[model samples]
Target: MGNSTFVFVVFILVYLGMIFGRLPRLALDRTGIVVLGAIALLASGHASLEGGRSGIDVSTILLLFGFMVISAQFRLGGFYSEVSRRIAGLPVSPGALLGAVILVSGVLSALLTNDVVCLAMTPVLGRGCIRRGLNPLPFFLALACAANIGSALTLIGNPQNMLIGQYLNLSFGGYLVFAALPTAVSLLFLQGIVLLLFRGKFLLPMAAKEEPERPFNAWQTAKGGIILCTVVLLFLFTSLPRDLVALGAAGVLLLSRTMASRRTLDTVDWQLLALFLGLFVVNGAFEAAGGLEIMKDGLSRLGMSLASPSRLYGVTTVLSNLVSNVPAVMLLLPLVRDIPGAGYILAVSSTFAGNLLIVGSIANIIVAGEAERMGIPFDWKGHARVGVPVTLASLATGLACMVLI
Candidate 1:
């Protein structure tokens, strides 16, 4: 086969691995599969490490890595555990607690990466519910759904948004202007749907057995909080490059006396960063092989070129559900260049689409994994019951906001 054909075969097989979440009997996960694909392209002399670095968008990687470190600081400081305790410690009813879970998870997710928020908060929320004699299922679903919706509130909220914002030159404030209303509305819609669905099932006959989690340290939390806030302000107010700003903030956190850098770095999602790098390399080679152009031509012939924001939105949602959002966004990004308001379309659609299925986003997966480990029965059916309606409502709100903008 020719270069384009070889790239197409490797790309398709790689995405198949992504969909399946592993290789058949190979013990290779999505990142490993992507790394293998990149290596394959390199072996064929169709790509290079330098080309991958360029394709990876070094600034975006830096920004993502910096935030991972900041998130690590919070995780190690036990800030997320404190927040969960405070929420559970309240003298609130089940409905009120549900609303709080939705709102808090959403807002924190809007500020931090949704995956990190879910990873840190899931255990605390789950065990808190156990201690309270409340069934944790609804709350766990709420956390996952709200995190997904909330992550759309800002470009920094999720990886795909970061990639879209950095590569598209989207204004942070401008994107927020478009995203704020929809994300807020999506949170409200999610809260209502979850409350209504789980109203009668919010309690168990008895609280499940609970266990103690990581302890909170006030000084460590305060140190991390200061650095996080500074990073956010700099992102909003200054013209300085965001990657550098975020990286600098992360570096400061590494200087902490109590929390060792090794502990903080341990919380970083190195697998995710590697996944990004591998996708960048493989995707670069695929593009160079004219695969994107070929797909564009094929889509254009189908009257579905990405220049139409609506078509792009629809396609993004479908592909995100099929292969997960990050890979879907990477696949579509090249075609969206110069397309009006494509940034908003990609960000809004891909994010809300994640609520459609458990496997659609990492936040959802994190919550589910935690539930299983805690011996709570969380299944695709339970997730879909909430995910389907929340996803529909979120997409509707996002579409209206996009139209108004």
Candidate 2:
């Protein structure tokens, strides 16, 4: 076979691996697939280290790494625990707790990535709901759905939004104008769904509390707070590259005297980083092979351009569910050109689409992982019950917002 054909075959395998969540439990993960693809490209003389590196967006990697550090700081700090405790402490009905979960999930997701928000909040909320005589599943699903919906409201809400905003050069505030309304409506819709579907379950008798007081690390919390604030300010006010600003904050958090640097660094999900790198190399190769151009032409022939709001929305939603949002965005990005309000469409659709399935977004997976660790049975069917309808409702609302705004 020709070198290009071999490269293409390896690339196909890599994506297939992504689709199946791994290479069928073969000890290889997404990152391994990506790295293997890069090696294959080089071995077959289809590309070089220079080409591969050039293809990977250093800015995107830097930004993601930095945010991971920032998120790690929060995880150690007990901020998430504290917040969950405060929310649980509210003198409200079971319904109100559901609303608070959705609200907090959305807001926190807008600041931190949705996945991190879920990672931090899931256990706390889950335990709280169980103690409150509430079925934890509804609340957990709310957290996942709300986070996905809320992340759509801002450029930094999720990784895909960040990539689209950075690549398309969408202003921070501009994207918000396009997404805020849809997100607001979607949150309300989510609240209603939980209240209707799980009302009886939520009102079940309370269980005896195991630990009345939530445990947290003060020093870790302080470090995380400082770094997060610094990164947000830099992203909002300063001219520094977003990636550099985030990485700098991460570096500072890692140098703390309280926590072991290795421990803190270990919390960073290197597999996710690997997934990004592998997919970047694989997608880059496809682009280099003129595959992307062909896609763009085919899209054009169908009277679709990424610049068209509805078309972009449909594409992002479909692709997000297919390959997961982040990787899907990476694949489709080249077809999109800089256009007014396009970033918002991409962000809204890709993020909201995550609510489509348990595996549709990393945030959902993070919540599921944490829930499993806590002995909660959060299976795909359980998730799909809430996920499917909520996703459809939210996507329709988002599409309407795009049209109106």
Candidate 3:
């Protein structure tokens, strides 16, 4: 095979692993495939680590790492546990409890980023549901879906959005203008659809299981909140560069006398960061190998050039489900740089479409993974009972809002 063919083959194989969540008859997972792809490209001279160094966006990585530290503070301080306990403790019916889960998850994701929020909140919420004699599947589904929908509302709410906003140089406040309404409407749709699909199964009893949780610390929680707020405000009002601002906030938080820096640092999702780096290098190789030109022609022939916002939305929704949102978004960003409103197309479609499958987003995977660990039967089938309707309703709501107002 030619150099171009080799790089393209590697890219397809890596993404196939991602689509299936693992390689067939092999132990290689999505992260492993990505890392190997990047290594293969560098080793074969299809891409250069030195020349393609610029392919990796350090600012985006810093921003994601910073927010993760902030989220970790909440997790370690037991803030997430407290919130789940209080919400699940309300003297309300099962429907009311589901609403509470959706509401709290949506708002928290909008602020804290979705993946970490789901990771921190899932077990507590799962245990809370079991304690209340309610089945936890729907609740887990709601948390994952609401987190995805909620995280759609802002530049920092999810990894793909952060990558989109920072790389596109889109205004923090400007992106919110397009996102806020759809987010509100989509959260409502998410609640209704999940409730509808899981109609008779809401109050089924499940055995109680305790997962590891941190003791509550008010000082650490408060400190993390202040840092988060300051970082967000700077993102909104200042042009100090979001990466620098986020890194600064993270730096100051690391200087804590009470919490060990090791513990805080341990909370960061280093694997996700590494995955992003690997994809960047692999994508750079693909583009340099003239794979982009071949793909463009193929897409043009297939009548999905990605210039039209509607077509872009459809492709993004499908591709997001197939490869997960971050990789799908990373692959498409360079293709849409000059397309008007393509940023919104990517942000809304990828975020909302992630709710379509358990493998569609990291938040979904984390929640489902936690469910298995807790001995709960909340797998992809149970998830799809909620995911499919919720995805359709929310995507329609978001796309309409994007087109209309």
Candidate 4:
């Protein structure tokens, strides 16, 4: 078979594995599948090992790794837990509490990684709701939806955004101009939907109970907070590369005397990193073999042009749901690299699309699983009841925002 044909086959298998989240009847996960695909290309003489390694974007990976480390510091320092505990303990009523949840989740997810935000907050939020004798479903649902929406606010908010921003060389400040308004609108939409759907339940009397929480480590929290602020500021105003700024912050956090480097580093999602590396190689091999050009030609014949922001938005929304946002963005990036404002559109649409279904985004999945573990029983039907409406509302608002701005 030709090199292009071999690369194409490998691409198909890797994406299929992504869609299924694993290979059936094999212990191999999505990361393993993609790694195997890259290996397959190398063994078949379709791609050189050195060439495949070069396909990986080191800056994107470093940025992602740095953020994960920063998030880990926050997690271990009890920042996330303390914040949620304070929010839940507020003297406000249930409706206000829900609004608070939405606002906090959205903002934090925008700055921090959304999945880590969801993972850290879900358990505490669930426990708080149960302890207060309030239904946990709406709050948990809001956490997931808001995190997904808020994550669209910045390139560092989620993995796909990071990849798109780094690969397309998008300006962090410029993209935020287009993203902030839509993300705010989406968060408001999500809050309203949850309120309308779960009305009357927020007025329940608070039952006093012991809320299990990590003791707030003031020093560690302060250390992490300072570093995080420095990183964000550097990214915004300085011409310094984001990866270097983030890695520098992570290094500062790692130098803590009280916190063990091992504890902080352990929180890094190495599997996700591996998955990224493997997919980078796989996609690189395909691109090197001219597979992207072939796909572009096929799309052209079908009268589909990804260079158009609107069409790219629609395609990203569909593919994000079909194969999850990170993989979807990776698949689409090579095609729309030069399209004006393509990065911003892809980031917003794909991230918002995660609210369409529980399975659509890793953030949603993390929230759902965490809720279930907390005995909240967050099933698909409950999720879709809120997800579908929120997603549509957000997407409509985001699309309009893109057009207007």
- lDDT (10s digit) by residue, model 1, range 1-405: 887788899999999999998888898989999999988988887777763443668888999999999888888878898899888777899889988999999999988899998988988888888778899999999999999999999999999999998889888888888999999999999889988898789887545556777789888888878888888887788888988998998899898766778888888899999999899988888888888888888998999978776677789888999899999999898888778788888999999999999989999999999999988999999999999999989888888887787
lDDT (tens digit, per residue) of candidate 2 on 1-405: 876677678877877877876786588766677788777776766665584443778787787788777877787777788898788778898888889989998998888878878887887787777777767778889999999999888777788887887777677766777788999999999998878887677754545346544368887787677777777767667777787777888888878776788877887888878777777777777778877877888988998878877778778878887779988888877776546666566778888889888879988988888777767789898888888889889888987766666
In the order shown, what is each candidate's alpha-carbon RMSD? 1.3, 2.5, 1.5, 2.0
In model 2, which runs have C-alpha deviations exceeding 4 angstroms? Answer: 51-53, 205-214, 301-305, 338-340, 373-375
Model 3 clashes, total count: 0
Worst 10 residues of 2 by lDDT: 205-214
Poorest stretch of ten by lDDT in candidate 3? 46-55
Stretches > 4 Å off in candidate 3: 51-54
List per-prediction Cα lDDT, in the order shown.
0.88, 0.79, 0.87, 0.86
The residue-by-residue lDDT of candidate 4 on 251-273, one tens digit each, is 88888778889998899999889
Number of the top-ranking candidate, with lDDT as the measure: 1
- Whose TM-score is greatest here? 1
- lDDT at position 308, candidate 2: 73
Per-prediction tally of clashes: 0, 3, 0, 0
Clashes of 2: 3
The 10-residue segment with the lowest total lDDT in model 4: 202-211
Q: Estimated TM-score per prediction? A: 0.97, 0.91, 0.96, 0.95
What is candidate 2's TM-score against the reference?
0.91
lDDT of 1: 0.88
Ordered list by TM-score, greatest first: 1, 3, 4, 2
Off by over 4 Å in 1: 51-54
